[model samples]
Target: MKKRNKFKHFLYLILALAMLVYALPLISFKEGWSWASAFGVAWSLFAFLVIGAHLHYLLGVDEEKQKTLERIRAAKLREWQLKWPEDTQRRQENM
Candidate 1:
């Protein structure tokens, strides 16, 4: 797979692992089976923050990818125009 897709999958795996770890303590704490309330709450909050940050990062990555695609498309159009200037007029006529 592409590097970007691989990185996205890695991020998803990290998020899933984080959620599992966070929930484990919460479950144990709820069952009156653990005395790590303070630590659990702190860890859970930290995990939540990490997930939020990851979401923001993903959004930024998406925007960057879109910009890259737009740049590529524009470059291709320019190249095409240089190759076939008359095609532009034909396209305009078609429109």
Candidate 2:
């Protein structure tokens, strides 16, 4: 991951957290605060924001791995290009 992408992801997470914090009081206080409502909010934030974001990040890692593998395979092919074949009349002479 590049520095810029990390910064952007961090900024997005911060913004989301700030928004949730700002809304917590309003949601809980509006209906006079209950344990269930608070729990629901917490669960929703974790499931949707944290888990979802991390899942997306994990998926991106696989994509990056694939690109790296492709590059490595290409390099290996280039390295072996010189020794690819030596097809000549030797096989016909033996037969």
Candidate 3:
């Protein structure tokens, strides 16, 4: 399989593991497991997810944050211009 496919499989595996953690606590609680052990298992699962997230970011397998910020800024500027047409015209003329 290709590298990207492998990565996707890895992510899916992680997702499955995360889902398992969500279900495990409920099962453990029902099975009369001790609170301390349950908490430990949950905490370890959370740490696993945290590490997985960091690894994902390190690999840059996501959209660029700057692009999202730029889109937000552009939308805000458009909203401001719509609310204050005269201010926008004045700023444009000043340039």
Q: How many steric clashes between backbone atoms does each model show?
A: 0, 0, 0
Candidate 1 weakest ten by summed lDDT: 25-34
Model 2 quality (TM-score): 0.40
Per residue, candidate 1 scores C-alpha lDDT tens digits across 1-95 of: 66786588568758766686758644455556455766676777776676766666655667788899999999998998797968777899999
For residue 91, give model 1's deviation from the true position in Å. 52
lDDT-based ranking: 1, 3, 2
- Runs in model 2 deviating more than 4 A are 28-95
Candidate 1's clash total is 0
Each model's lDDT comes to 0.72, 0.67, 0.71
- Give the TM-scores of the predictions, in the order they appear: 0.39, 0.40, 0.34
- Write one digit per residue (lDDT tens) for candidate 3, span 1-95: 55677577567757767776676655445556787667868776776776577567646576577678899999998998788988888899999
| lDDT for each residue of candidate 2 in 25-85, tens digit (9 for 90 to 100) | 6555467659977786776577467645845664477678889999999999886775454
lDDT measured at residue 19 in model 1 versus the true structure, 0 to 100: 80
Worst 10 residues of 3 by lDDT: 23-32
